[model samples]
Target: MGWPYLGETLQLYSQDPNIFFSAKQKRYGEIFKTHILGYPCVMLTSPEATRFVLVSHAQLFKPSYPKSKEKMIGPHALFFHQGNYHSQLRKLVQSSLNLNSLHKLIPDMEAIAISALDSWAGREVINTFHEMKKLSFDVGILSVFGLLDESHRENLKENYCIVDKGYNSFPTNIPGTTYHRALLARKRLKQIMSEIIYEREEKKIMEKDLLGYFLNFKDEKGRVLSKDQISDNIIGVLFAAQDTTASVLTWILKYLHNDQKLLEAVTAEQKAIYEANEGGRRPLTWAQTRNMPLTYRVILESLRMASVISFTFREAVVDVEYNGYLIPKGWKVMPLFRNIHHNPEFFSDPLDFDPSRFEVAPKPNTFMPFGNGAHACPGNELAKLEILVLIHHLVTKFRWEVVGSQSGIEYGPFPVPQHGLPARFWKESNHHYRH
Candidate 1:
């Protein structure tokens, strides 16, 4: 088949991506053609194609999709910047997420996790997703900008929701539309970021938080970055770090709840670590978090199975050739990670929850939870720490069980619990551990 130009396909794809992507893979193999909102798209479904598009030839594939950029993240975000500007901003921002910094932040991360868990005591049924989202947001605020005010926290959360909902709606600045609301949210966010930057500059606060680092940062020529550049970079990091971690943790809880054996193993490992620590005097250290290899694998497995940001869309800068097929210039090319992640060729029993798949023998380029290459998520290290620490805390403190049906989780852009991840947790009676 050359290409399928069915209008209904776009509707179906937008409505339920899991079924649509699966049907395309079954019918069209590794590479397929489809249309979205009247634009042609080549959907790449194999690891080879994904590698080529995202890693090998990423320069030719830019992420500044007209709709996604103009509607979703706003034009001011670093996500839409290209060439030297993007490179410089990425470098400056990426420095904050470096391994050493992340290691230093582990105690803070664990303290936040423990605080969140402490608040949930005596509750029978709770939505883990909501709690994780709040906790993740708070951590991001504190670690990124040193935000501690309660009112500011609420405003940030509300603005994030507005912006997230703005992405899929029609692009317009007209009031009452989703896009318009998102624009307003963007404006509000930019104002808050500006105020923060100005205050940091005026007070000369030399703290080690990301905001302080950016404020004092200088370019190669000794020229300091502008306030707008700093604001955009901060917003970009905030957007990427907050929700992605929350989604991963939510899915991890779901998987652990469904699989008793895996949950028990993870819990046992956590207990052993706690027992060795003697007193709960020190928070969960970065060294200890990294030592939890099994916990890391579980988070990776959950991320692989739950394809967050399911497909990445890139417009062809110029005509490109792949397997003798011409991807014409300006055509939308979407690398479908869901298809690649679920493909039996790369993973055995692709649909099953098995962290051992990664433990026994990990596959490079085949498993991309954060993505790949130059554009690969810079906050990957921080995300890993956040997920691992959250799981470590949750598993050690309480035992969780699915409230009702224990069927495998459903897939959204983010793997969302169909029933709000309703789980029952009780304080662990073993009490054999200190931390």
Candidate 2:
């Protein structure tokens, strides 16, 4: 579908990715062949095709994170795990971050959201992407990870930024290259996490956060997980959940800002819910949060449009066929998530941001914001809760607008608000605010 060795790698990196994929779709059918990022890959765009790869033949695939990413995130990453080990890890995470346990996170989440909103109230402009990243990172570390990176913000954030940029970068071993920097950053984070692990263990300190669960969780053999494994998994959890959720939250704001009607409607819903809970704008219980159906739809539509993780790669462990296209063994297969998510056939007038479209669930395999099959994101509830809680506070309190030289979306590896979606934000005074 592309060049001899490089395939469509350069085209993907340079050109508008939608245009690139659209042009290729016209040339080849939905399930076509191409080589990119050092593999002869098959890109699945159709829902049926994606399902066959992700579900029908789930066991035949493994996560295809590049060599550089493997090094940075470590062997404990769910991407590198498979079979029983992967399932066990997911169960452990779900146990701690699930609905019941999630209630404990609400207060911290609300406090952080309020403090951040207050900070922005006096500011001239806020970068949506940057600000959300800080908010998400803070909540994740302080509330979710047992304050693991509570005091290591600069060091941890620097290393995470390096690793994230290197996720899709060329795997060059040269001293100045992105890959090299990412590797060095990975080393630093490992050292930092290792220290945190040891400190927690030696002190025998137990907090109700995910770190405590990880440290105390034992397998069938009654053996607790090692410090390195816990540390690596913590890094992986923060890496996977933090930025992507932040990106979605940023886009949610941008969309709400663009459509005043939607913003008002969502705000009305939040206001009603808060008033029902005695009108104090306090952190909500789990049931209270999910009770706002339209707010939930807004979250869903935002996820569909933003599609933070545009594509997920899996390595075919054996030869497979989809839509009569032979997918050879060992080839990398990527589910073109956004393509399907944005497909006109699946969503009427797909390009439009209409939260009402989510009123009715799409057909099977058609709406996969968190992916599908065995590898679907386990922390989906937590991610949604984070977004839900933050948005609850936002629409209930503030009115914001995009303000910058230009505003748009920069979608590739992740969808982010272009130019960081700088915006002017302010909320009513505390007395005038709902209380």
Candidate 3:
């Protein structure tokens, strides 16, 4: 703790958070106590400790977030709760992302990726992360609502962007503030969702989407999910899908850009699939997407390197002890994902961008990009599917060059390449597409 109440919040925010975390770990060992965001938190960096908190002893800790954030994303979201409600809501979400559902959405996901890449082609300079966000958002929508109308999609995107921008801003309801605008936008999102939900209910549509699962849900007590509950969970899933996936995609681009040989290898791997698909005339099969071992390793390495979620907050529901330390009830417990990922003990030469390292899996519990245990990201499968689709089309049909210095990282609450990795893209000539 730095100050009486302010704590080390300034120190954490004023510099690179990784640097702060590293410094603290060096001085205080793998487990240390620090106050952040007005809460006393115990930060655990070792894999055993992390596993204990997130997996084995998870019942003693409940998901926690700032009240302002809870309100911003809708308090009814599953991430803010545990127990029966969380379990039930999580099942509904999982039903929509299951393999059968994702298989049906593959064509739509590929279409979104192709359209996005085509639009970015020949651009002077586009922010790769922002463009990727659009692609991910479209896929997210497809997963949640099936084929939404254009007008509805546009409205949802506009409002959602406002809410996303304001999510990390200072929590002030004062007039003319970013957070205020965000709150208003969040309301608009809820209203828009209500209209969509009402339409589904009135039409009696029963499609195999997340909305369908929510619509058809009835609990043990025969209680149906409230409209507010459904809306919050949809928004929450979208929030989870967008930035985290986009950030990792951006890092993949930067890492490939820095290493010509690796880029060539990844492109070659994807090119084999392109040729087998009859020179880009065929859609990728689920099996083909599953077979790109080299590209898959790249994805795994990027996730490990980015560690976007970084650390998650879980409050001690009751006093708990681990490794001879006591966590008082109500204190926050954080498992430092980035630190664990970068620790040399787990990943040799951790700072190097080596996709090959993933050829052999890391020891159990050492690699958790989407978190661990029950509250892990539900849309993870869908996220990977969309990424594979995009990369398949991208490497086979387009070539891009970073437009600015590509060495810096920026955190808009998640680590992304500086300025979202400004880059220029052009279509790969038809000659290259020929067998």
Per-residue alpha-carbon lDDT of model 2 for 40-84, expressed as tens digits?
A: 888889988888888988888887777667777887776688898
lDDT of 1 by residue, 181-284 (tens): 88888789778777766776687778777877777777778988777667667667777776678778888888887787788888889877877776355577
Using TM-score as the yardstick, the better of models 1 and 3 is 3
| lDDT (Cα, tens digit) per residue for candidate 3, span 362-418 | 999999998999988888888888888888888889999998687777888898888
In candidate 3, stretches whose alpha carbon ends up further than 4 angstroms from where it belongs are 433-435
* RMSD value for candidate 3: 1.4
RMSD of 2: 2.5
Task: Tell me the TM-score of each prediction against the true structure.
Answer: 0.91, 0.92, 0.98
- lDDT (0 to 1) per candidate: 0.76, 0.80, 0.90
- Those runs of model 1 whose alpha carbons end farther than 4 Å from true positions after fitting are 1-16, 66-72, 170-172, 406-412, 433-435
Best by TM-score: 3
> What ranking of all candidate models by lDDT puts the best one first?
3, 2, 1
How well does model 2 score by local distance difference test?
Answer: 0.80
Off by over 4 Å in 2: 147-155, 165-169, 173-178, 277-281, 405-407, 430-435
- Candidate 1, residue 214: CA error in Å? 2.5
For model 2, what is the alpha-carbon lDDT of residue 10?
90
